[model samples]
Target: MTDSSPLDDNAFSHIMADPALAGSACSLAVACSGGPDSMALAFLLSRWCRDNGRRLTALVVDHRLRQESAREAETVGARLAALGVRVAILVREGPKLTRDLQNQARLARYGLMLSWCREQGAGDLFLGHHLDDQAETFLLRLARGSGVDGLSAMSPIEMRGGIRLVRPLLDIPKTRLVATLEQAGQAFVQDPSNLSDHFTRNRLRRLMPTLAEEGMDARRLADTAKHLSRARQSLEFYTSQHLNRSGRLYPHGFVRLERATFLEAPEEIRLRSLSKLVSALGGADYPPRFDRLQRLMKRLEADADGAGTLSGCQLLVRGGRIWLAREPSAVSGPVPLEGVGSFIWDRRFRIMLSATKKWPKETDFFIGALGIDGWRQWQNSGREISGFSILPAFVRRGIPALWRGDKLVCPLSTQKSDHWQDHGIEEIHLIAGELFGKTAFSSLNMRTM
Candidate 1:
């Protein structure tokens, strides 16, 4: 490997020593775009992996938005192959391109890349984002008047989609990457879109030289991001502690929060906690807007005894506690429970059905949300569950139940048998793992370079 390469032996050594690669060394996938930055990364990583006895794979995502994408991917593959690195190209397939091209492209790119890494059993996915990109991101967020979390910009390591995503070159500059490629006599593709003003990133990039002359260089902006990132980390730590002490997650995509304790926390922690709850219970990809969340938090803490929905989740203030549940509209499914077995219903609750040996009869059932008629019939049955009346109808309707042709088989958790010992469907484990698993915001996991 060339000593002048952006990611030289010393750079790679430093990255390897960090927490990003703390675990036992395994296979890794490096995302490359055939650009100067990514190519330089691939070159250095290939040599490092070889010397360290670790396997490295070069992954390229071809957007296919351009006519030359296929050819470009092939060229990149051949170049990496010459360096003794295995290459895999995933093309963006299906659907005609539309508006919001940049955002859509990024989502598609990451989604595909993460899926590939999981399928390949790669330990970590390395990205080529560097100081220049981090600087641009910071400025873009700054122009939008973003908060400290946004200004912190990109992180050196992130846990996304159950994969470890590491950006080892964040401290290096774009010029260094270009210089590395030049010194090695390697060819790199330059996408014309980088010069187009239609994209905000491109517009900001065009002004970078002018800003640098005025003392707003990438190094300075990136340093600011690091400072804000440190602050964000501190907030994240407290946010986690606050949630654990004040809020408790419940089964079937619900959370039980101690209202008094939640409202007493600092405003930022309060907002962050509420955002975490809504996103987790709602199964929302992104949290609600900050201002909306701020208003909603105030209303919930002070006056929102009424029913309302935010981030596709239903909010109910019951007595002195705040209950967050998935909006019935957000969850729907009538999965057939084949015999005595456990099954996931509505992507929110895991329901298990079982019959005792004393029963000795096969039970057929269909699992679904307890509908309006089911709730009414259940009420008329004179089975008074304590505190059930305080629940909103929408929240009650989402309770999973088993049906056998107009017959109510147990509402949510239990299906009791005639004999106490022979409890039919003994213990339905109503699990809400997915909702609670990602309660913490992703930004919290971000570690700045």
Candidate 2:
């Protein structure tokens, strides 16, 4: 808690000791913005990586929202380079921002950074979200009427697309970060946008002092969020257990739930189970609204054979079970593939196209859902597909299929790897979304970090 002390090795090792990072002796990357928070983090990581005999890189994302963004990115690169850390300046390209500027920029920033990590073979990406950021996030989600999960704020470690997002400084104070930079004689830049009242975060930050006077200090707010995070962890554990017991997740990216068994669980578990089923099946980035989920739950309780749709997923009560599948109408349009390449269709399936001797050079190929028309074609063809015939009709409608315009090239059936090879595709590796591997809930280890 000392104001002027620099980040010590013990504090830094707490995060490095994480199980996710233990085997990740590969290079590490940090998102640097030239701000005190990120700069201090870069300084600490450079030293740690050097001592640990691992490489470290600083990734500066130039969002280009402001005219000086590019220059600031270069300045950050220069500073990190001086600290003996390799630097990569990533520029945000394509499409002009028109609305929801902050959110859009944030998404773009992460997209650029994560893509870099994947390309560079870095398995861990460190961030500089400190105690104040957690407190601000808590207030922001609270004002928006967030549920327990949302109010829990940021996690200390998050796994996204094979990359470990490690926030070692989440429990550290911003003042300490600034003091660290000062103590090291390191210079940092202040982003002008942060001072603007036009953003909600800035407004909330300005109100922090006043709120602290009213006894809702950053430490108290962050501690409350930590407690809620533990509660969310407990809820997630039960939700996972309930889902495993009551649901059967298929490789086709749909889930079948025993209606009575699912409904027999506690109401909170039921809601969370539904959320997980729909979110993963529909490939949605966020969960559906809590209010809408509650309404759906009530309807399911009242009507045993009810059919409902929410967040791009359809829920049908058929026979004695509940079926969750992507809504046919919400399925993404065909993705054109020129030749041998891998593509993610509807975010649910990974489709890889490999060229064979029979692969036609003049033909155009695409991947899309089978839909009603394709389903009919499949049915009438009398192909007697082993697995296709057994799938529920609603589930069949959303199955990923290979297409040449209107002609159904091939159905990406789970049991038909040889079938795809016959169509000049050597392999198509398809993994259903992470339906079963629900991550354990985590919070910052305050005693260590």
Q: Per-residue lDDT tens digits of candidate 1, residues 1-449?
A: 11244446776777767764534448899999898888988987887788788888999989888888899899999999998999999999988578899999888888888778755767588889988999999999999999988999988877554456788888888888888778778888887888789999999998988998898888889999999999998887788778877766544345667788878899889898888777766756556888888888778767746556897788877777787777888866666555554444554555545553222245445667777877887788888555566666777777777676677654664333342223334555433323433434232322111
Pairs of colliding residues, candidate 2: none
For candidate 2, the per-residue lDDT at 79 reads 85
Best by lDDT: 2
- lDDT digits (tens) for residues 1-449 of candidate 2: 22446677677778667765444546789999999999999998888888888888999999888777788788889888899899999999987787988899988988898878865767688999999999999999999998899999998877554456888887888988898888789999998879999999999999999999898988889999999999998998898778777776665667777888989998888899888777767655567888898999898888878798998899888787888898888887887765565555675665656654434456666778888788888778877555667667778888788787897866775444665666655555334323334431111110110
Instruction: Report clashes for each candidate as comma-separated counts.
Output: 0, 0
Off by over 4 Å in 1: 1-5, 21-27, 50-56, 118-123, 250-254, 281-285, 302-314, 325-449
lDDT against true structure, model 1: 0.74
Provide the TM-score for each candidate, comma-separated. 0.70, 0.76
Candidate 1 clash figure, as a count: 0
